[model samples]
Target: MKSTKLYFSALLCTLFLFTGCKDYVRGNGNSNDRPDIILTYPELVSMLQHYDKTRKQQFAAAVGKDEDTRINHFNLKDLKDYIAYIEKECKKKNIPLTGINFISGAYPDNYRLDPKKSNYQALIMMPATTIDGEENVSFDPFKSEKGKPLSLKEILEGYSYTSWTYDELKSRKSKKKSSRSTQKGGGNDLSPAGNRTGISPPN
Candidate 1:
């Protein structure tokens, strides 16, 4: 009886180990507890590629390309090569990155309202203000107006962004992978980085 109980217990433990708990999903939950990090352009492209290989091919087709030039035409490799340089720029800007938002870069002008519709619009949060020092690190990359910043609640629900905290994102990292530019880069910019601000978060 004792041996049977031990075996069962071990089995239960193994099952629990294999399946951990699930936190928030689909951009649900407040970021009050932790800082949010946005992925750079290169980072965004890598994630999209990781999650969906077909998307790139589809994107290429949509663009009337002869071949699937997701990396070559987009300058994905160049972005990867310049990853260090980009990190330095982020540090200088003090933009906190949490996780990569996986979406296509096809819709930059808000052509589609639902982020799910476009398949490419990773919206990373800019860093919040420093407490004791307040304005020192306060940033509002999503601000639509002079004193008003776009609400995260609104952004998540409307845009369908999947946000993971930094630790969670680190766990998702794989040995494979790393950008073309919409972001500022090797003079080969692919996408635009977030509007990292040095201003204070509005009251």
Candidate 2:
């Protein structure tokens, strides 16, 4: 009887440990225990090269050469603060903050081709949630106050981004490759390996 009781207690504890947090999905909870297959720096270079080519071919005429924003990277502190703010807001409304959705968008016509601007064509990161488990919604910040969801234009204007130029991206990739080769040849490893399970867009 004692052994059976102990086994049952252990099982209950295990279940609780796994299912205790239900705030969000994806990387959270035991439902997704498998490790994500992260892309390498080289792989990312290939992917972004393709994307850059595609973006230029598709939107160059409309947005102008080297003016259509191909990528946007955020500051770590800003991203963390934004996530925390969204979580608090969602909690107040009893909505589970499922994930952030990066929806592609364009700025207003006047700012579309400005090299000085951070958002010509950009991805708007919106907090996502499900309504009654049927319809999914991406919550737009400032929607309640302004009667319009936050636009990519507004977001870019408000927050600062440290996006890299296309030339910088190629330069970094070359440096990363060179460093890795030196490390393989028994040279001192100055930096951490780039082969990790996470998406780190060029900064």
Q: Among these predicted structures, which one has the highest lDDT?
A: 2
Q: Write the per-residue lDDT of candidate 2 for residues 1-203, one digit (tens) a residue.
A: 99999999999999898899544556465655655767789998998898777766677666554446555666666777778987776565555666776666555555534434533566556676543232234444433222223222222323342241211233334443221111121234222101111121212
Q: Which ten residues in a row have the lowest lDDT in candidate 1?
A: 175-184
26 in model 2: Cα distance from truth in Å? 11
- Candidates' TM-scores? 0.21, 0.46
The whole-model C-alpha lDDT of candidate 1 against the native structure comes to: 0.38
What tens digits encode model 1's per-residue C-alpha lDDT throughout 1-203?
99999999999998887677544344546634544566689998888877566565565566554333233122445444344443444455554422222222333434344432232323232333332222323222333233332223223323344351222233224422111111222434223233221211110
- Runs off by more than 4 Å, candidate 1: 1-57, 72-97, 100-102, 107-203
